[model samples]
Target chain A: MSELEIAGCSKYYKKNGEPMCALAETDLHVKNGRFVSIIGPSGCGKSTLFNIIAGLIRPSGGHVLLDGKDITQESGHVGYMLQKDLLLPWRSILDNVIIGLEIRGVSKKQARERALPMLKNYGLGGFEYDHPDALSGGMRQRAGLIRTLLYDKDVILLDEPFGALDAQTRMQMQNWLLDIWKDFKKTVLFVTHDIDEAIYLSDEIHVFTHRPGRIKATIEVDLPRPRSEKTLMNDRFLTLKKELLLMLREEQVSSN
Target chain B: MSDQLKDNEPFIEDPSVRTTKLRRRAFVGQVLVGVIILFLWEFLTRLGWLDSYYWSSPSTIVRTGWKAITQGTLLQDLAYTSGSTILGFVSGTAAGYILGLSFWWSELYSRIFEPYMIAFNAIPKLALAPVLVIMFGIGFDSKVVLAFLMTIIVAAIAACSGVQSVDRDLEKMLVSLGAKRRHVFMKVVVPTTIPWIVSILKINISLALAGTIVGEFISSRQGIGRMILYAGQVLNIDLVWVGVVALSLLSIVMYLGTVWLEHVLMKGRAPKS
Candidate 1:
């Protein structure tokens, strides 16, 4: 059984007396411990789809099940990261990491003990008590990832986690993320508008069409694990990027 | 002492240290200006340039304050005023925070109470102090009630806006993190409004003191306000100045104490970035 299953999910919104659709009969299933990427243009409801899977928003018409059980009503089970690295500035790096644990009713002492290993493993050992403002943007994002991963959840939803980083820092983060994922083996659903990122990180790519977003295509990335920016220079990565770009262009024309 | 070999050297300052030093220097400059103004007043009075009958010299005021202190009347009056001010401040702040939280929770409560609150606030509370004294008598209760009336209005307004002004993204983030309505209130809403509430409390401290002093002047047989009234009636300008200076000092001390308390409580708690 899959770790997450979204069957026939749809969402809609009304704007200025005009009916606008965000998702339409979208069905997706993620096997346990798989890295899946959802790629599309802006306003494609990719984030909306992730919200549905994470149970942040209820589907207008469908069911979201986890491991053969309906979890549509349950929240806090999935770890989510947004575009902005929303680290509480008042909280130290260690405190930020342990916030999810604290929220889930893990005792503070126990949470700190559990969090220490993760912090040390991620190279944030000596900076446990240092607040978020003291850290650089790249360091902040790394701490955010540690925050989500330390929650000990089997599924994680990353919404443009590295979208705020510079090009050099973003490349560094991609390598770091792949290493973390390789070790954790958790089910991952990453949303991004960057085609290069989609091709680089994903085991499989789901291309989304324009508004009232529907799946355009599902392309499996046949690349090896622990890929780098050098992989982007290779023919396979370029070909996958080309295919995704073409699909997005056709969707853009139709939506226009 | 011999082991501590001291070399005279200029201090190497951090950037933030230099900034702090600059701020302290500015504060000292303001204090020097205040001292200069006081010295001018004293000089004018001593030289007979200003009328000594109405405006007493600073030394005369200080002497009057010393006489009041020796007789223990100053301490007695201070106790009466401080007691009323403290009681009224605590009651008003508690009422304000509760009402503000209620307003945040229920739109219906806000609609019904908000307009009435505004109407009541607009009526000069000082004008009502006489009527309040008439109703509650010349004891501490009337003074406290007057002070409470003065403070709660502003505190409630500040708290209501603070609660309303919380960042929407923070609320959404908390909600999406599986926090229920009550949890969101406890975790996100409360922390965000604390700095605002503290600032409001600082503002209300002076208002609360004013309310107490006004009540004292109109009805109380004792207190700094009554002392001022008697001194003015007898044309003892020095005693009047003493009472004014005492009140000013009390207000400054209270404000600074509250600020220090805020620092202690809000340490590592504020979300400023």
Candidate 2:
């Protein structure tokens, strides 16, 4: 059985008193413990879809299912990481990481105990008491990811989590993220505009059309696992990158 | 080559050393300015170019202050004034913050009350001092009520804005993590509003004092304002100057105390370097 399914979900808004579609009727399925990426042009409703999936907003039509049970319009079933590292400034790094557990009625003492080792494992051990401002950008992002991971949700949705980093840091984060994701093996659906990132991390890439976005194509990435810097120069990686770029360029030109 | 290299070395000073030097220079300048002003005042009054009777000399004002202190009247007046200010400030801020949180909790209450709050805030609170005096009588209650009236409006407005100004993304993140309304309020809303509350406390210190003094001016048996009024009426210019000086000192001390509290509360929340 599929772990998650989006069946004909859509969203509409009123602009100047006229109906406008933000997301068309869309269907997607993620098997348990697989990484999927959604790549699109700007303003293509990828975030809107993620918001629906996260239950922050309801779709205009259709349903989202988990384990073949309808979980649409309901929240707290998935972990979500936004583009910016939204760590609460006033909290210590350890306190921030355990917020999810705290909200779930766990005692702060117990939450701290559970979160301490995770912080050390993630390379943030000695800095647990430090403020978010004291951490580097990449470190802050890692803290944010740890916070989401500690939520213990079956599915995790990452919305351009590394978009704000410089290239070197972005590469480092991607490698670190893959290592963590491989170990955890949670159902992952990541959204980004970077085709290289999408190709590198995802088992399948879903290309989206411009505004009023719908799934334009779903291409399977057959690259071998344990992907690294060497994988970037592989012939298969170049071929997949070229194909995705051409598809994205075509969509951009047609929209313009 | 060594001489050339030494000459070419960049001029670097430790940041802490530079800061101390700047602070010392500023302190000297401030003291110098105060001394110059005092000397000019004494010189002008001694030469009879200025009316010493109406505008008492600094030395005479200081002597009167010493007499008031020695006689214990100054201490009594300071205690009474400060007591009213503190009582009113605490109660007013608590009530105002609770009211603001209620408004945040209920949209219907906010919509109905916001316009009235704006209109009430626009009215000059001093004009209402007489009414408060009449209602609460010529005791400590009247001064406290006046101070409460002066401070509550500002605190309510500040607290309301603070609650409303929380980052939407953070709220969403919490909601997605299974946080209920109470969790969100306790974790996100209250912590985010703390800086605003601290700032309003600083502002309320002066405003509460102003309100208390205004009440005392209208009708009060004891207080610095009443002291000033009585001294001026009796043509005791030196006593009046003493009252003014005491009030200025009280304001400075209160302002510095509030600044220290802000530094303590906002220690970890400061922006990244």
Give per-residue CA lDDT, model 1, range B143-239, as digits (tens): 9998898888887887788788777665555555666778667766676677777888788889999999999899888999999998888988788
State each model's TM-score restricted to chain B.
0.89, 0.91
Tens digits of lDDT, candidate 2, B58-85: 8888889999999849989988998998
Q: Give the clashing pairs for model 2.
A: none
lDDT of each: 0.84, 0.91
> Model 1, A94-137: lDDT tens per residue?
88788777777789899999999988887687888898888889
Which 10 consecutive residues of model 1 chain B have the lowest summed lDDT?
A: B2-11
Q: Candidate 1 local accuracy as lDDT?
A: 0.84
A159-232 in candidate 2: lDDT tens per residue?
99999999999999999999899888899999999999999999999999998999999999999999999999
Question: How high is each candidate's interface RMSD, in Å?
Answer: 2.5, 2.0
Report the number of the highest-DockQ candidate.
2
Q: After superposition, how far is residue A9 of candidate 2 from its true place, in Å?
A: 1.3
- Which DockQ values do the candidates obtain, in the order shown? 0.45, 0.64
